[model samples]
Target: MNRRRTPRSASAEELLSTLQHLTARARQEVGLHQARVELAQALQGKMLPAALPSFPGIRTAARYAPARDGLDIGGDWYDAFLLPDGALGLAIGDVQGHDVEAAAFMGQIRIAMRAVASTAADPGEVMARTNDLILSMDSSLFATSSFFRLDPATRELAGARAGHVAGVWATADGRSGITSDAGGLPLGIETGQRYPVTRRTLDVDGVFVLLTDGVIEGPSLSIGDGLEEVRRLVSAHTGATAEELADRVLRAAVLTGHEDDAAVLVLCHEVTPRDHG
Candidate 1:
C-alpha cells in the first residue's frame, strides 16, 4: 500500500517574512546598480578635459554627451590641448561600446595619447604609438580615433584617422566637404597598424570639424543620411562662431534621437581685422 503526501501550507507570518526578504534583496540590487552608474559617470567627467586652453589665433570648442538609453555614461571623448612646440592637438574617439569597461578603456587611451603627444613627431606617429600602447595593454576593446595637429600661425592642419569618422572642412563662404585622406583600422585591431597622415593647408577663414560617429549615426538613421544631415547643418552655419556651431550640432543630434553618445570638436582660425584688410 502506498500513502499520498500532502504539501505543507505556510503560516501568514512565514509568508510575510519570505516576501520581506525578497524585497530587501531587490532593493539591494537596485542600489548596487545605481552606484555603479554614478561611479562610471564620475570617472568619465574626470577623464575629459574640464576647459579648453585658449589659442592666440584659433577658436576651438568641444561638446560631449552620453547616450540617454543605457547607464548614460559612455566611452565617447574629445580633447584639445597645446603641444610643447606650439601646435594644437585635437582628438576625438569612441570605444567599442557604451559600458563601464568601455569607459575605462577610453580613459586609458585618452591619457596615453595625451602623454604621447609631447614626443610624437606628427599625427601619424601619435596614432601609431597609441595603437601600439593599447595593444600592449592586452585589451579586447578597440577604439576609433582621429588625431589632428594644427599650426595656428601657418594655418596648416595635419591629421590621421583610425577607422574614425571623416572630418569636415568648410570655408567661411559656405564651401564644405569631407577630409579623409589618411584612414585605417581602429586602434587595438592589430599589433601593427600604420595611420597615414593627411596634410591640408586650411584656409584662415575655414572650420575643421572633428567628431565621433555617434553624432551622425543612430538606430533610426543610416550613415549616409546622417553624414548628409551633418553636412547640411554645417553648411547652414557658415559664419557662426565655433561655440555656436558646436552647440547647434549637438542639440540637433540629441533632438533627433541619436541613440549613442556624441562628441564634437570645432577648430577654426581666428580672423582679425588685419586679415580682412
Candidate 2:
C-alpha cells in the first residue's frame, strides 16, 4: 500500500485563491511605497528638483533616483533656473549626509546659489559665495557641487566644480567623453577658496551631461570603469532625445545597483535649419 501512495494535488479553487492573495499583496505594497515617497517629499518642504526650463536652442531634462534602501529620499538634488542676465543656471550636488537635515541643507544651498548667482559674475564667483554662505551656517555639513552658466546663443558652458564628479558629454553624431574641470574643496570647509572655471562650446546637435557620483560609482563599480561605460553608452545612443538620454543613463545606474542617491541633468543642443523662403 505504501509503495502505491502518492501526494494529492491542490484543487483549482485553492490555486486560484492563492494567486488572488498574492496579487492583492503586491498592489498593497505598491500603494504603500507611493505613499511613503509622497510623505517624504512633503516633509522636505522645498522643491530642489530640476524641471525642464525652456531656452532657445536647448532642451533640458533631469532624473533623480534614491538609494536602494533609502527613505525614498536623500541629499542629492538638481536645479535649473534663468539667471538675472538671461543665462541659464544649472547645478547638481550632494550634501554630506542622508537625513532630514541633509535634505534641508540641500534646499538652503540651492536657494542661496540662485540668490548669489543673480549678482555673481560667473560660475567661479557663484560657487565661492555659496561656499562662504555655507560656512556662515555654523553647521558642520559639507557638500560637493557643480555650477554652470549656459549661454544659449553661443552654446558655451562656463562651469565650476567643488570637489564633485566631472561631467560627461556627447553629440548626436557620435562624439562623447568626460569633461576635464579643475575644482576646489567641498563647500563649507574653508572660508576662502577658489573653484576653477571651465568653459567649452558645444557643436550643434551636441549634448552635455551633468551627473552626481551615485550614478557612476557604486559598490560593484569603480568610478574609472563607470565613466568609460557611460562614454560608450552616450556615444552609441546618439538619436535619443534629452529625456530619453537621461532615462537611459539612470536605468544603467540602477542595473549596477544604486548605492547612493543619483541625479543627472542633460542639455540637448538643437539647431533649427534656416527657412527656405
Candidate 3:
C-alpha cells in the first residue's frame, strides 16, 4: 500500500526565516513609495518661487498647495520675474501630470518661460518661442499657461494665454469679471502655434487674480462655475491685502474637497481704495 506519508510541518526557524523575508519585501516597497513621494515634493519645492519679486505699487502674493494629501505632486507653478524693459513679468501654469516627471517638467518650463520672456518684447512672441523650446525637448506632455507683462507704475497688463482657464479681475469700485483674453492651444501640442495677446490697465486699487484650474474645477463643477465662484470671492474680499486675498481664494478651493494641486497669485495695483471725490 503506497499510501502518501503525511507532509512534515516547516520547522520554527524555517517559518521565521520565511516571515522575515516577506516583511523585508513589504517594508522595501513601502520605503520605495515614500522615497518617490519625497522626491516629487522636493522637485516641487524647488520649482516654486522662493519669494515673489517685489515692485513698487505692486503688491503680489502667491500660494501653492499639493494634491492627494501630499502623497503626490502635481505640475502647477507660478513665476514672477523682471522683464528686459523693466516690466514685471508674471506667469501661472499647470503641466499635465502628477509625478516626479511632471514636477521636473514644470520646473524646466518655468525656467524656459523666464528666459524667453526676459528678452522677448511681445507676449505673443514669448509664447511662440517658449512653445518651440518645449517641443524641442521632445516631451509628450502638454501644459496650460497664462503670462503677463505689467508696468508697475501704470498697472498696464499685456497678457497671453495658452489654453488655460480664465482668470478673474476686480476693480476698486467692486466690479469683477473674467479676464476674457484670446488664447491658443496648450504648449507641446504643435509647432509654430501663435498665441494672441490682450492688454488691460488695472484701475487704482484694482486687483487681478490668477490661478490654476485646480482652484476652480471640481469633479461636479464646470469651469465657468468655478470662474464665477472665484470672481465672487475676489469681489467680496477686495478689502483684503494681496496676501489675505490669496489665502481666501486658496482656502475656498481647499474647502471644496479639491483633488488637484492649486496655485493662486493675487496682484493688487494699490491697496487703498480709489478716491471718489
Best by TM-score: 3
What lDDT tens digits, residue by residue, belong to model 2 across residues 1-277?
5697688999999999999999999999999988887876675535565355866667788988776665667788888898877889999998877667788888889899989998996899999999999999998899999999988777788999999988888877667889888999999899899999999886567778888888888877888777777778777775677789899888778645677888888887777622222
How many backbone clashes are present in model 2?
A: 0
Off by over 4 Å in 1: 1-37, 273-277
TM-score of 2: 0.83
TM-scores for every predicted model:
0.84, 0.83, 0.85
Off by over 4 Å in 2: 1-36, 43-46, 273-277
Candidate 2 vs candidate 3, lDDT winner: 3
TM-score of 1: 0.84
C-alpha positional error of residue 196 in candidate 3 after TM-score superposition, expressed in Å: 1.2
Better of 1 and 3 by lDDT: 3
- The per-model lDDT (C-alpha) reads 0.83, 0.83, 0.86
- The digit string of per-residue lDDT tens for model 3 on 247-271 reads 9999878645688999999988874
* Best-performing candidate as measured by lDDT: 3
Q: Which residue pairs collide in model 3, if any?
A: none
Report lDDT (Cα) of residue 218, candidate 1. 76
